[model samples]
Target: MKYSIISILLSLITLFFSIKINLETLIDYLSTDGKSQAFHGLIELKYLYKYYFLILSFLSSLFLVFAFKINELKPFKHSAAFILILGIVSVFTAFWKWFI
Candidate 1:
């Protein structure tokens, strides 16, 4: 039960990192000219956020596995699995932006 709760929480956190871009970053990125160093920096930061998504996805996957094996986690098993799958898909579909 506790494992499931933690798994669900971590899965959500991973999903959050996958999609949590602020308007300020976009505004800054759009406002800067292509030749500006700030433009490159902002782009780099956005890619860095994706790196976090990968790391968290890995951790969340582990928790989901543990939770899935436990009988006590029956109530939350589906939700935990679903959210974790969503987080992973966020990474795979980054180029396509299929589901942010």
Candidate 2:
């Protein structure tokens, strides 16, 4: 139960950070001039956010596995798994954006 609660808290924190970074990137993108063609700046931000997403994914996965193994947080097990999956998808999307 304790571990599950801790994992949930950590997942929430990771989510908060992820949202913050995404908003910052969006704001930067919107503020820039389309005619300026600031591709380089976007590329840099993409990489930066990609790594941040990766970190979130890692932390989420770690806690998710722990929660699964302990099997004590039955009520929250599914929620934790969902967060882990979402984090992974975000990481992949970030990487895809960087590559493309």
Candidate 3:
């Protein structure tokens, strides 16, 4: 019960950060002149953010696993998993933007 609540809270926090990163990315993209390596660099950064979020989410899953298996520290595992999934999706979207 406690673990579930904690997971939800952590997930919310992770979501907040994810959105923050996205907004910042958008602002950065808009601020840049649409030309040259700067564009590429921004795209790359976007890709990187996806990967980073995915990893963090995965880590959150691991935290949940640890909480369950260890029976102590269970608060963050599910949150991590959720974040990982979100990151995976974000990456996919970014790839689509890049390729098409």
Question: TM-score per candidate, in order?
Answer: 0.64, 0.68, 0.50
Give per-model CA RMSD: 4.3, 4.4, 5.5
lDDT of each: 0.66, 0.61, 0.53
For residues 4-56, could you state the per-residue lDDT of candidate 3 as single tens digits?
Answer: 44545555555666666666666656655658435555465643644455555
Clashes of 1: 0
| Candidate 3 global CA lDDT score | 0.53
What pairs collide in candidate 3? 57-84, 60-80, 61-80, 61-81, 63-77, 64-77, 67-74
Q: Report the C-alpha lDDT of model 2 over 1-100, residue by residue, as the tens digit.
A: 6656666766676666665666556655556676544574554455464456566566666766787887775778787767666655654453322422
Which pairs of residues collide in candidate 1?
Answer: none
What's the ranking of the predictions by TM-score, best on top?
A: 2, 1, 3
Candidate 3, which ten residues in sequence have the lowest lDDT sum?
91-100
In terms of lDDT, the best-performing candidate is: 1
Number of the top-ranking candidate, with TM-score as the measure? 2
Pairs of colliding residues, candidate 2: none
lDDT of 1 by residue, 1-100 (tens): 7777787788788677656543334455556686874455546455555656677667777777787666654668788888888878765554322222
Residue 28, candidate 1: alpha-carbon lDDT: 51
